[model samples]
Target chain A: MNLTIREALLAFRRAPLLSALSVTTIAFSLFVVGLFGLVAVNLQDALRGVAERVEIVAYLLPGTPIEPITLATKDIEAFPEVQSATYVSEDSALARARAELVEFRDVLQELERNPLPASIEVKLRPRFRDADHVNDVAERLRGFGFVDDVRFGRDWVEKLDRLRQVAAAVGLVVGAAFAVVAIIIIGTTIRMAVLQRSREIAIMRLVGATNGFIRRPFLLQGAIKGMLGGLVAIGLSYGAYTLINRWLIQASFFSNEQAVAIVGFGTLIGLFGSAASVGRHLRRV
Target chain B: MIKFTNVFKAFPKGGLALKDVSFHIAKGEFVFLTGHSGAGKSTVLKLVYADEPVTSGEVRVSGFNAADLRPRDVPMLRRRLGIVFQDFRLLEDRTAEENVAFALEVTGARRSSIAARVMRVLTQVGLAAKAQAYPRELSGGEQQRVAIARALVNEPSVLLADEPTGNLDERATRGVFQLLRDINASGTAVVMATHDLDLVRQAPYRVIELQEGALVYDSAVDESRDQAATP
Candidate 1:
C-alpha cells in the first residue's frame, strides 16, 4: 500500500500491453543466456568424464620382487596428486588383455607364456587430472628402479587438456557476449517503457515531485518486470532441460544458487536500466 | 507573489522567446496575461514557474529565485504553485478523485487527510458527483474542472493557468472562468494566460498584454497614468 509500490502497480494496470511486452523481451533475452549456461555446464561435465580416464600405467620390469612392488604401489598411492594406485600382476594383466581385446582373444589364450608385464596403474585426483600433472606422476613412477616404462597416453592427455582450455575460453567469451546482449535489449525495453509514460512523468514533475520521487516507481516497476522475466526464463530453461533429458541425453538443470543468480541478474538489470532511462528523461524534460 | 525583472528567454534552436519582459503580481491579485499565439505568453508563465531557465535576468516566484535555482529546488518552488495547461493533463487511467489526490500524494501528504482534501476540492470545482469517473469518461469542461481541483488540492498561493479553457465550449468556458474567479476570491492569486478577449472583458482584473515576446501594454500602469494626466 506504499505510494511508490501503488504507483508502480498502477503502471502495469494502466498499460498492460507495454508492461507485458517489456517482460517478454526481458524473458527471451535472459532465456538465451540461460541456454548458453546450460551448454557450458554440460560441456564441463563431459570434459570431466574424459579427464577421469587420465591414468599412468607403470609397467614393471620382469623378475621384480612382489614385496618391493607392493611397497611401491602404496608409495605411489601416497602421492598427493594420485587418487589411487592398483598393482596388476603379470598373470592378471594377461587375463585382462584376453578379456578386453576381442580380436586378440584366441592368440592371447594360446600364448605359451604370459607376455604382459606387471604394472602399477596410478589414477590422479580430479583437480590434478591434467597433462602437466599426469606427466609429473609418470616421471615419479619412472623413478622406481623396477618400473620398465611409464605410459600415460601423453598425446591423449595433452589433447584433453587443450579441449578443456578451449571449452572454458569459448564459454567465457560466448557467455559474456550473451549477457551483454541481454543487458542492451532489456535496457532498450525499459527505455521504451519510460518514454511511454512521459506524460505522467511531466505531470508528476509539474506537481512538485522530486526526480528521486519520480524515479522510484519506475525503478520498482522495472525491477518487478525483470523479476517476472527472470522467473519465466528459469521456467523456460527447466522445460528445455526436461526435454533434453527426456529425448536427447541426461542433462542437468541449474543449481538453486545459479538459478537465483539469474533472477538476481535480471532484477539488477531492471533496476539499473530504469535508473538510466528515467535519469535521462528527468534531465531532458 | 511573482516578480520578473527584465527576463530574457532564448529558444534552443534559435530566436529569443522573451526579451526584457518584466512584471509583478502581488498576493491575492487576479491578473490576466493576454497575447496572440506565439506572443511568448506560455514562455512567460514557464519562466514564472521555473519551467524554463532565465536567459539573462531575475525571476523570483514565491521566494524561489529562478536565476540560480538548483534542479532539486525547482520542485520545491512548484509545490507552492499550481500549473494548468490547455490540455487537461489528467492521467486517463486514474479516476477524477485519484487524479486530484495524485498531486497531494506526490508531496508525501498524510494519507488520512488526502481523501477529505480531495473531496473538498472536487466539491469546490463542482465535480464531487463525478469523483469516480476517469478522465475519458468526463466531458472536456468536467475534465478541466478535475484538473483545476488537482491544482487547488495543494492549497497553492498562486495558480498559473495557461489557456485553461482553450478546449472548452462557451458554457464550459464560462463555468471554468467562474471557478477561477471563485478560487481567486478565496485569497489565492490567479494568473491566467489566454487570447480570449471576451473572457478578459468579463472580469475587472488587471491585464498584461504581450506582442511577439515583448510587454506591449499593461492596463494597470497605463490606466493609472491616464487618470493622473487627466487630473
Candidate 2:
C-alpha cells in the first residue's frame, strides 16, 4: 500500500468515533436527496403512463369514399410525430360502441341505421406526446377533405403539459436546494474531521512535510467516507422504497444508472468538500 | 549553519517581537538562546524554521533566505533543521518508534530503510527498549527523548530546541540536557532556547541573551572584550 493510503486508513483507526460520525452525517444528508430522487423518478414514470393515452381522433364525413380514407391513413401514419394511425369504418365503430359502452349497448344495438361516424385514431410517438405536438398532428388531420372534425381533448392535454412544466421546475429548484444543503453539511462534517487532527497537521508541517503531502491523506479519507456514506444512503433509500411499495403504494426503486449516479455524486462531494476544507485550513495555518 | 542579520519581526496586531537582532551559528557549534518569556526566543526559532515571516532584514538558514522564501521552499528549508518544542509534540497515538518513523516517512524516505533509521535514532536517544511504548505510557523525559529521536531521524544539520525541558522534572530535564549535549558532541549544531539559567551555566557553550525583543549580550563578543580589558 501507498503511504498516503496507509495514513488515510490509519486516521480512521485512530479516531473511529469521529470517522463514524462523519460517515453517518454524509449518509443522512445523501439519504434526503435520494428520497427526493425516488420521488422524481416515480413521478416521471407516472406521467409517462398518463401521456400514453393521448390520442387525436378524426371523425370522417358520411358517404366518404374508403379508398381516399385508406390513403389518408397511410399519410397520417407517415407523419414524423405519428406513431400509428388506425381507421375504423362506421359499422365497426357501432360494433365497438356496443362492445365497450355497457349501458349504451342496447341503444347501439337498436340503431335502425348506422349513425356512428368512421374515424382515424392518431397516436403520437413518446417524445411527441406533448400538447403542441398533439395539436400540430390534429390540425394536419383536419386538413383531410373527408375529416369532418378533429378532437384530442385540447384542454386536458394543455393541463397535463402545465403539470409537467410545474413538476420539472419544482424538481429543479428543490433538487438544487437539497444538493446545496447536502454539500454544506458534508463540508462542515469534513471540516470537523480536519480540525480534530489539527495537531497532527501541525506536527507534519514541522517535520518538513509539504502541504501537498499533508493534504493527500485527508482528501483520500474524505473520499472514502463519502463513498461509504453514499452506499449507506442507497441502502436506506432502498429500504424506504421497499416499505412504500409494501405498505403505502406501488412504487419503483432506482435503476442501476440512477443508483450509480447517486454514489458518484457522493464521491464528488467528498472530494470537493475535503479540498475546500483542507485548502482553507492550510491557508489559515 | 544559521545566520540572522538585523532581523525585525512584528506581531500581527502591533509591536516588535524581534528588534534588530542578529547572530550566526557555525557548523557543529552549540549555542544557548536565553531570555525570559516573551523575550523573542521562540520568535527567533520560528524565523529560522520559516514558521514566521521576518518583518525586515535577512534570515538565512542552511542556505535558504527567509526574506523571499517561497511557500513551497519552506519544507525544503525545514528539512535541514530539526525543531522540538517545550510540549514534546509527539502524536499520542503512535508508539515511540512510530513517532520517529513518521518524520522519515513524511520526507518520502525509502520504505525499506525507515525501520533501521528509526531504531538508530531511538537507540541514540537511549529509548530503544521502550520503542513500542506510547507517549502516555512513558515519562516526560522518555517522551521528550522520543521527540528528539524524531527530530534526529532526518539527520538535520542544526537542531533547534525551544524550552525542550520546560515541562520535565529536574532529573528528567538533566537527562534530556545531557542527551542534547551528546547529540551536539556527535557533530550536530544545537541551538537551545531556554530561560533555565542553571542549564545555561552548566555548559561552556556560547550564550546569546535577549531583553525585550532586542539582543542585549553575545558572550562570544562580550567575553573576548572582558579578556582584552583584563590588564
Candidate 3:
C-alpha cells in the first residue's frame, strides 16, 4: 500500500535468483537451530515426565499405631503438593508379600513372624514431582513423629541435575554460534544487494532522492527473505520432528501420545521472531 | 540562470581544466560551449551542477553558491539542472518509459503523475511508440532522445548537454539540435558542449569557444563581437 512497500516488492520481483538464494540461506540456518531447539525441549519434557512417575514411600516408626498413621496420611493428602497418599498397615503388607512369594511363602512361614514395616505410599502433584521439591517435602515429613524414614531417590536426583547443567551449557554455546552465523549470513546478503544496486543508487541520489528512500527497498528485501526463510525452517523442522516421533512411537520407545506439546507453537513463534530480529538488525544500518 | 566568475578548476596533476573562466547565462538563453578534446567543456557543466567544486573564484546556479553548497544540497541543485550525456546513461535494464519516469520517481512524484509526465516527455521526444523498448532495442539516436526526455522530465530551468549526439549520424544530430532549439525557445536555458564545428556554424546560437582552458571566442548577435577579435 505504501511507496516503500511498492519499491520493496519491485526489488524482490526483479531479482529472483538472489531472492531465492538469500531466503534459502536463512531457512537452512534457522532449520539447524530449530531442529536443535526441538530436541532440547522434548528431552527436558521427557525427563520431567519420567520424574513425575516415581512415587515416595514414608516408613512409619515401629511403635506407631495404624490409626495415627492413617490420620497423618489424610493430613498429608490435604497438603497442596501431595497428589495422593495411602496408609499401608504392617499386617496388610505382610499378607501382600506372602501372596506374591508363593514359593517364598513357605520360606516366609519358616520365619519366626511376619517381618514387614508399615509405610505410607505418597504421590506428588506434577509441579512438585521434581527431585528437589520432592526431597524438600520428604525432609519436612521426616520431622513428624509418625514418619521414621523418608525416602525418594537422592542419587538419581543429583545425577539428573548434573546432566541438566551440562545440557544447558551446551545449548548456550550452540545458540551463540547460530546467532553469529545468522548475522554473518544476513550481513553478506545485504552487502551483495548494495553492490549490485550501486548504479541505481547513484542515479537515485543524483535525482534528489534521500538516503532513506534509497535504502528502503533493500531493507524490505532483507525482511522478506528473512520471513520466507523462517517459514521454511519451521515447516522442515516440524515435519522431521513428526516423522521421528512417529518412528519412536512405533518402536515402543515412548508411550506418551503427545510427546512434543510445545514444539509446534514454540518453533513457529521462534522462527518468526528470529527472522524479524535479523530484519531489524539489517535495517538499522 | 547561471553565473561563473573567474572560476578556476585544477586537476590532481596540476592541470588547469578551466583558467580564469567567467560567463553568465540569463533565463531562456541558448548557449554553446565548443572546444578541442580536454578543453574543459564538461568540467564547466560539472561546476554548474556542483559535481566538482571550483578550485578558486565563485560559481553560482539557481541562487545557490556552488562553492558553499553542502553535499545534501547537491541533489537539489541537480534537480533544477538537467544533464544529457553522450552515452545516454540510461539504465540498460529499464524500458524507455521507466527510464524517463525514474527522474520524477526519485523526486517522490506520485505514480500517476510519473506516468503522465513520462508519457508526455516520451511523446515530446518523438519516442512515444518506443516507450516500452529497452535501451538496447533503440537506435543510437533514440537512446539519446530518451536521455533527453529524462533530462527534461523535471522541466529543468537549465539543460546541459555534453555531446548529446556524439554517437548519432548527421540527420540524428540535426534532429537532436532542433529538439534543443525547440526546448530553448520554450523558456528552458540550454547549454550544449560539442566538438562539431559545422553544427555550431550552421545552427546559429551564442557560441563560446575555449582553446586550452581559455575562452577564445564569444559570438552572439547581442554581444559586441569584441572577444571574437582577441583570439
TM-score for each predicted model, relative to the true structure: 0.92, 0.97, 0.75
Could you tell me which 10 consecutive residues in candidate 3 chain A have the lowest summed lDDT?
A250-259
Tens digits of per-residue lDDT, candidate 1, A26-123, equal 99999999999999989988888888888889999999999999999999989999899999999999889988999998898889988889999989
Docking outcome class, model 1: medium
Across residues B99-149, which tens digit of lDDT does each residue of candidate 1 receive? 999999989999999999999999999999999999999999999999999
- TM-score of the candidate numbered 1? 0.92
Residue B226 lDDT (model 2): 100
Q: List where candidate 1 sits over 4 angstroms from the true fold.
A: A62-80, A87-116
Model 3 per-residue lDDT tens digits across residues A143-225: 78878888778777667767767877988898678766765665566566666766776667656666666666665666666
List pairs with backbone clashes in candidate 3.
none
DockQ values of all predictions: 0.78, 0.87, 0.50
Model with the higher DockQ, candidate 2 or 3 = 2
Candidates 1 and 3 compared: the better one by TM-score is: 1
lDDT of 2 by residue, A1-285 (tens): 399999999999999999999999999999999999999999999999999999999999999989999999999999999999999999889888888899987887788999889999999999999989998889888899889999988999999899899999999999999999999999999999999999999999999999999999999999999999999999999999999999998998999999999998998899889999999999889
Error of 1 at B219 (Å): 2.7
TM-score (C-alpha) between model 3 and the true structure: 0.75
Candidate with top TM-score is: 2
Candidate order by decreasing lDDT: 2, 1, 3
